[model samples]
Target: MSATVQTPTTRPQIPVTVLTGYLGAGKTTLLNRLLTEEHGKRYAVIVNEFGEIGIDNELVVDADEEVFEMNNGCICCTVRGDLIRIIGNLLKRKGTFDAILIETTGLADPAPVAQTFFVDEEVRAVAKLDSIVTVVDAKNVVARLNDSHEAAEQIAFADVILLNKADLVPAAELVALETRLRTINPTAIIHRTERCMISPTEILDRRAFDLDRILAIEPDFLGEDAHEHDDAVTSVALRETQPIDVNRFNQWIGTLLREKGLSILRSKGILDLKGSPNRFIFQGVHMLMEGDDGKPWGQDEARDSKLVFIGRDLDAVELKAGFAACVA
Candidate 1:
């Protein structure tokens, strides 16, 4: 008898979809819809709330594993670290879940969270970033965009723009909102949703963050002027080779957020920890912090920490100094 040889099959990494928008933009409503739908794939949802009230849902199955609520009240501030920890924990019970859906606070920017999947080696290995779905309130979108940088970035980074609460606006108004969104993000797939009801399948696995598209939008991804931005809003990337003193970093971050949270739109970091082989992941919005341990370091890996901050009129010098103080 001839011996049979079998090749091992490698499972594809699960994709994580980030849902973001301004406060009261119907993120929770959309999440609730997804949770109830019979989509064949089991999902692990991470909902970051900006207040102390927990999500009071009765339909959630496997409550602990299926629904994770970051009660930090600052979605952008605390979600990145919470995400890493939650995802890491979920991975340990592999096969129990199929995908991850993170719902950012309504007034939060989604870029920092989206960047987390790419910047963190351990995170990248375990999960792939699928898409950023921004739920826009049709009735208030124009005013929100005019009033907040967070609103603008949420729309700008979206792979899929869900113009939720479309019924609240007139047909003409909705059309105008669509046009404005196109002007900001010409390539995003736009969907008009009533009461935040849409097929989950429509949003999943849609590799929306195409590098070519981003380049087309910015046209300066690699140039020295890439970090430059208009008044009120900017994006900055910070990097270091040394591990961070986690406790000091936390204290510094806490103080920084408390003092300047209103100015900072979003902040996220993939830290190389001092004396620890595992990477520490953290993300925050204004005054919230969430973090957790990631996978072990590989021998060929470079131990470095990289963080990205997106905000309004951020003083780079002071921001860099604060990070330097955390260095081991």
Candidate 2:
């Protein structure tokens, strides 16, 4: 009798949403609402203990960087040895939960947390990057944006940004703050709220990783191309109509990231490669980058590549020259 060989079952990708905000932006309050609210969804929250967040759920993990199997049948682990390990452990018990929400430290950059889903193969296969929801203190954003680049970065990387504490400021002030945020990241969906009052659907299950939607959402920075600066941190957009040599482009980007990753808060690009019929889309946080083939270039459409870099003190002349060298 011939032995039957069986293949491993592939689990459906669970969405992981990252929640970020400044220290006093009511992130904890919003998180508390998500946890204690009567919403039917179950969440495994990885929170910082120093923050005054109240997690009443049985799946609430400890603050330390260690792994533990909880009594509630949920896997609990701190974001140690990379989120890949903790997330991999969670996937092992995929039957216990519906989704995952990770709350980064206040004043922390969301890039590292966002990069985890892209950098790890195992985690990427079983989980989809839902969206990054950044909660901002509307009354304090002016001072915050000026005080720290971390504040600016949190705002820039957001898929959905919540202007919390909106009641504290006047309507005109609110409009002005919104305009400032839009200039930094015109693509993000902004919602004004009092005390972080936002619907769960607005943030959850957002297919942000879908490149086709991303292409439409990214703002047309090329037309005006007026450089906006938030202290040392700023955003740079690069566009070229020519197709690039794949190997040379990769080499340049790899080295660039290695040397300047610390300064680069976030990076994203859509490429037109010389030999490839399909478009190449890539984004990175610091030195870690992930890229894949996106949609095909139609015969009638113009073959143009666009790249955006959000960093501190990025040399446009040098970077643009490096990119131009890669033109096929």
> What is the Å distance of residue 210 in model 2 from its true position?
6.5
In model 1, what lDDT does residue 168 have?
83
Error of 2 at 14 (Å): 2.7
Candidate 2, residue 45: the lDDT equals: 74
RMSD of 2: 6.7
State how far residue 230 of model 1 sits from its true place (Å). Answer: 11
The list of candidate 2 runs beyond 4 A from truth reads 1-9, 32-41, 56-58, 65-85, 118-125, 209-230
lDDT of 1: 0.69
Worst 10 residues of 1 by lDDT: 59-68
Instruction: Estimate every model's Cα lDDT from 0 to 1.
Output: 0.69, 0.74
| Highest lDDT scorer | 2
Best by TM-score: 2
